[model samples]
Target: MKPIGLDKAEHAHVESSNNATVNSEKLDLSKVKVEPLFEKFVDFDTFTKSDFRIVKVKNCEEVPKSKKLLKFILDDGSDKERVILSGIKDNYSAEELVGKTLLAITNLPPRKMMGIESCGMLLSAICEYDGEEKLNLIMLDSNIPAGAKLY
Candidate 1:
């Protein structure tokens, strides 16, 4: 096969390879295909306005009869407290997650998951590749104030 290029000889070779008899009277554009670009973009300014805070995990336990649910008691530096349920059981043990600091979306409307009311959503970095999943729980420095909004 001849090398592919803009030259007339290369175009003739490509046409012959497909068993297409090119007509001199008509220009064949059937072999060309145009693909639409797909992309999704989010505005950062809109995303930055969410109220996210660092909270200390005071307690962690597995929910009854649930394989992937774990309940957490988060202290956000006020008299009020927040309860969150996270699906991190497969990534870390209950004992390992207790007493850790994490980021949570504080202002989200409360939602019930698996019959338990969750007040907030814990934030974590997750990556999946080749049918395997990995989760990296966010950890905060001790100096960071509890309930401090993440900018």
Candidate 2:
């Protein structure tokens, strides 16, 4: 999704205002703005039916030979487990990510990344600054059941 009129000065101002340091080497959200030609609406029911759920991150490890890939083992409150690969290594450490709950798209078809089979996608908000990508994993409060659907 594109954000309109997003510019480097605006990005730096926002980050500094929030007391969030812009990791220029990793994420730079100051060069491009969202172009204005994208659709702005979606079918509510169909969109709601998309399989977004809360899952506990049981394990996390770096994918061999890949600097960006991190493999995660997630529990979705079922006997079957889901394995996902996310490009958040630059943003998070394995120890910090383990035992945390994340929202995931559980029904996506499996895709191979770095020879690893990923069955789902861990969802996070991303921002680009100076052509660098940064991820903000969704945080939750209290204890929510794993596999609880996002409404």
Candidate 3:
């Protein structure tokens, strides 16, 4: 593939620089599929109504007896700890997620999953890779403090 705004030599340099840390062969996107972008548009006012914030995971554990759920105890800069349940057990283990910073929509109304009240929803990227579904949580930099609002 041709690189935009870069000459052949410059593009080769960039690709070589990344090869030390990234496998260039896996950069191919031909087998990956993503959902179509939303056809409907929302006004800025309506879009800003959703509260997106950075939250630190204080604890994460599999919801007992459930195969797809993971319960998260989060620090959202509030006095009370926030609890959100995400169906990501298949993608990540609780031990691997604790203490990680993540993005979440914190203003959603509470909903019960497995009889537990989930107060918010964590953001994730979902797509089909080589005909198989994949999910990845939206992780944030560790230096970003919890409760920081996203514009």
Candidate 4:
């Protein structure tokens, strides 16, 4: 059965975002190494304290004096725009990330980095692939509205 709010025509069954296929062939799993799972699990109440939401990139630019940081102006379904700085410049360019939908933790306390107050944290995946470190930001489907909470 479809979820409570979903319509029958909405089913697309799209492929996973990180399929990482090349020429219609899947990447060899042997060359990829993921980190071990956490030894301790947090209680459900503590997990729910984290407010994960969808955010849309309105504008993105390289931060001055930082080679690995990119500044982002995001639409988090709020009246005011949100600013976030991420250190993913080595893997992604600012121009390529504009207008993309992404997942972020919205209720974190503001933290200072490079003299900027980043209000939240963007979610990402990291692993060792092909003997090198690789990071991919947790992108969401464009259809998901900004500030939609994740369960």
* Runs of candidate 1 exceeding 4 Å displacement: 1-39, 129-131
**TM-score ranking, best first:** 3, 4, 2, 1
State the lDDT of candidate 3 residue by residue for 1-151, as single tens digits.
1111222133222234323211232333565578999999999999999999999999999999998899999999889999999988877889978999999999999999999999999998777766777676887778999999999
lDDT of 4 by residue, 6-72 (tens): 1223433325554444334455556778999999999999999999989999999999999788999
Q: How much does candidate 1 score in TM-score? A: 0.68
Give each model a TM-score: 0.68, 0.71, 0.83, 0.83
Name the weakest run of 10 consecutive residues (lDDT summed) in model 4: 1-10
lDDT of 2 by residue, 37-72 (tens): 557777788787779889998889988899878999
Candidate 3 local accuracy as lDDT?
Answer: 0.80
Query: Which stretches in model 2 have alpha-carbon errors above 4 Å?
Result: 1-38, 129-132
Cα error, residue 135 of model 3, in Å, equals 0.7
Clash number by candidate, in order: 0, 8, 0, 0
lDDT values, one for every candidate: 0.70, 0.72, 0.80, 0.80
The lowest-lDDT stretch of 10 consecutive residues in candidate 3 is 1-10
